[model samples]
Target: MEKNIQTKYWVVDGKEPDPGIIRQAGEIIRNGGLVAFPTETVYGLGASALDDNAVEGIFRAKGRPQDNPLIVHVADMDRVWELVSGVPARAAGLMEKFWPGPLTVILRDGGVAAKKVTAGLDTLALRMPDHPVALALIRAAGVPVAAPSANLSGRPSPTTAEHVRNDLSGRLDAILDGGPAGLGVESTVVDLSGETPVLLRPGGITPGQIESVTGRILLDPSLEPGAVIPGKPRSPGMKYRHYAPAAPLVLVEGTPSRVTGIVRQMLEENLLRGKRVGVLCREENAGLYPGAAVVGAGAGGEPGETASKLYAALRRLDQLGVDLILAEGVEPRGVGLAVANRLRRAAGKIINTGQLHE
Candidate 1:
């Protein structure tokens, strides 16, 4: 049964929200309502994982597929065992090192998580988010919250509370405005239920980082482009269309100069057709395309800066209402790998000028 949920929007001061308001949001979740809250990686649209109806609200609100499955989030490490039958040795190591951070692991469900939350799959994806606001809500609600990126399904993930309101204001119950997300990406999802540990999706954590601790880890082929059908994703972002924007985006891949040249060429071609173009590239290359609206991918010197600035840049382009978006690909290493992955998906066409294949 659906309850009459009055949409409430609150703008709280500082990193910590008011205890009274946080409790109010928690009660909403307890009563089978949706709430968007900030996590370290990104804001997640949350519902009680144990409540089938509450979990269903998330899918309806986001227009997400039921079979796509959801990530159950907990506040503490000890709370993990309640969701999953048992954690693998490698998964345990990862959780110990990365839990209370942006890592989600697939485990055999303990039968407590709602069928809707897992999409009736025996295994459930679980994580302990590394954000103060997220942790407080879970602790207050006293229930494991199953959540996905707090944006419309297949669109760019929301990095700030305002982004959540823009995409999902009237559709949900409330949004916890805890400022912008830190990592500005989703959690790294690893499937540990199978014999070999596999990375289902890449996000804030990189494959190299996970490999160091667990030895060799396998990358899920589903994460590759054109590998899986839409709505059948084993994990979030495995589907072909994800993290996209309203404007048609084309990704230019190669060295910075090569990418700049290709973007300039594409910008000119679009302009010849009288199309308004936007260029998303590094700060150094912004001047390459004079007529186009140029936005920096991130500051050149700062590490992980590109990943941090990616979604915000895309959102800005949408605000400008550009007809075409020409995004420059970043280096495919460290957090840059995650940034590049999102750009690849966001782009409708990818022109690879590089000699090496990804």
Candidate 2:
């Protein structure tokens, strides 16, 4: 807990992991210290799930709220039953379809295991992360890991290990530097605790994908301010303003022309008020806002590429010291839905610009 405590970070690449680095990361988890590592989704700040003291360290390191439960990450499907009490029939089916990918299922709290991870809730959110480095560390540590995004809570999730180092360098015991996260968004969290599977939070996996596997429509909970659902949280991103940057953010949604018009209008107004501004948009979309410093993330029309660059773009824009950020919203389909969801959260204000005249 010393302010000047030294932490080691090891950079690993691809499916093959460095055994020495994995061993060190495992040691840190075993000792109740925090270790940040990359998942296929976002990089996760991890600690031993069964160790109460280690779980506490994750909360302290991330400055996360205790009420907001952490997702338990396991190495593989075989270990799923060990963490949750009864894997409901629907949960079993979904796991069969989406295990080892960007899907998190909420299950009945398996008493002690649930207490260690969810702070004693009757439900627990669990996932088997598909990243090799993450799996390597979990396997090496020989325990389930309770992990959330590896950045200060409410800020953008760290996609790259460097992002982790930038936001949490001195705070964590060590970081497993496993390049950049592939999906670059949080996992799609689904609640299988109910009769009908509910889509708690959308991420790398789409709702259609979940429906195809479970044969049921995934429902989004009606979130009220400061309300925590009693059992398991329906979804991870519910009832919270997450993935936010330091500066104020405004989301521009609607038709292309209308969104562009609103951006131009907002930029002009901010400029008139002598406020510094930054814009995040696609290259084709950048021409809509002239004079504003634009950060482009994807080429052509690839939503996956856009999703991958989201948090990093926000971090860059935040570092630029802008007073306001104007983000263009993507179509809410496939990975684009996940991208837009994060952008909407990051953008504090959502502007429906579909009605605006260019």
Candidate 3:
């Protein structure tokens, strides 16, 4: 199959996505062409999940591995069971609570329709995206769309349409210009395939939130390096190094004073080794490492705003050709947990200085 190589970008505002642009995007997907659009979580490069050839195009466009499955975005709950053979009772409970939001439920026997989307896994990751543009495109196209983050595989996920164009301009068929992604991170992935529900990946929704709704204890996988399981993966974010940047990253976690100290030490060490260093922190911490180039999204204590800027900050820092990025970890509460989870994945090493500061 020759690759669908028509590289066209249709910029449309989310406030009022032009009907013509929406129709065009829908047509592209209907005809087996790849369309990149914004979800609340991130911009997803999507293809028709029902079409084997269309799913293959997504793998080629993103340079994603076949084993790393894609999430199927649906317009409504009724459409979900069409993709999955049998939706579990626990999954139904979660759907009632968290659907049309950030939660993605992985279900068993997702049928042949889902097999193409999940890379032949017995399980399928399904989400009802809250973004207007995402829901509009899925409804317009009239098919379950299998989408992954719209960036090179394993690179930082795109949270804006411009980021999508930057990473996939020549590689994609069309880009629907939605505004900035509200969540600025991927969806919270939960596995309901087993007798006990498990939280595969943390995101806008937390395990506590899921437990509150389902009255079940959700387990986080006790993952170790190089540990491979036998059957299909229950969660999407497991078994991969995701949201990485070009430059190496170091996570600085602790109180303000201790984190600052660690950042200074890292900068001094990098300077001694003749390497340029960049820090992803708030403006107040700029003075901590005077010689380093500091990038601040805003003042501290607003994790929602921090989450919005996280991916863009990483992309910008990566583009500057810095040798290393020292990022400050936010308090893990509310949206902060999602922000911290992404930072942990982006950082190559974590420096926990909680005790040192005390």
Candidate 4:
């Protein structure tokens, strides 16, 4: 991280980012300075995709590994074409359907983006964010922006400008505060640079939703819980432990009743040990845990709701200064897959009640 650098902060309307403020932010990017801005999914630490030095700054600011690639954000199809070697028919179809949303399509690099952005890979990930502020800032910059989640590496991804400020206050050049991100997770990454379209990382866009567009896509093996990733990661969040909070987190998975039972037992054990315990659970079960610092992530265990509130809940628990956090796992379906993936990666340990015998 850069030392003692001052960060400029600005609050703007999410629906309509002030042109003047966006222009100023854009100028910072044009000059190879880092800027943290909001996307529909999460806030991104952005720099010019074409500038290697600027792209390197993103890695430096977040302490991110250079081997994990960054996503390039563009405002329009023209810019997308300028950066990718070719858009396959399936990719084109996906772009038509999911562009300007929480989907990232990886294609063969056209050799236009900075080498640092692709992390020396032959492919590049690109997406058009579905937020007015993101679009406006990219348009104002007049260059493709290479970005990764704005928070410090391995922390929960920022869902609001305040989260960005908390993690990256003095490390970056500017922050365009466009309110809270609509989705609490990062974009869904689809790798089309291969023979078969592969889901590199699940996010707000679900497997069912992507398969609806591109016939049955393959989930990357790395998506499996506790699986090891070989070589470099083709996309962000694939090779590293991400979305973790300062406190150690333990995730419990099984039938809701079983998980609830296990978490309650663990919570009691921790409290007895004189440790502060925090519980991340569904809204319906908020009252079940006593004495522990409990946070309800979503209502009725709804996938979308859980995802949109997951990071905030984690950050909140950390703020409450819990010594340990116990998160309840959601079903790995729809957006819940993304939520579960993040929790698995964030957790220091995972207990599957199904794997435990009475």
Q: Choose the strongest candidate by TM-score.
A: 4
Q: Score every model by TM-score.
A: 0.94, 0.93, 0.92, 0.98
Tell me the tens digit of each residue's lDDT in model 1 across 39-70.
Answer: 88888999998999888888888888677889
**Candidate 4 residue lDDT tens string, 239-294:** 88999999999999878889999999999999999999999998999999999999
Residue-by-residue lDDT tens digits, candidate 2, 66-150: 6778898988776777766788777888888888899999988766563647755678899999988899899988888889999
TM-score of 4: 0.98
Residue 119's C-alpha lDDT in candidate 3? 66
Better of 3 and 4 by lDDT: 4
Clashes of each: 0, 0, 0, 0
For model 2, the superposed segments whose C-alpha errors exceed 4 Å read 114-116, 222-234, 355-358
What is the alpha-carbon lDDT of model 1 when measured against the actual structure? Answer: 0.83
lDDT of 3: 0.80
Instruction: Give the runs in model 1 whose Cα sits over 4 Å from its true position.
Output: 1-5, 229-231, 300-303, 356-358
Which regions in candidate 3 have their CA more than 4 angstroms from the true location?
A: 1-4, 222-232, 355-358
| Runs off by more than 4 Å, candidate 4 | 355-358
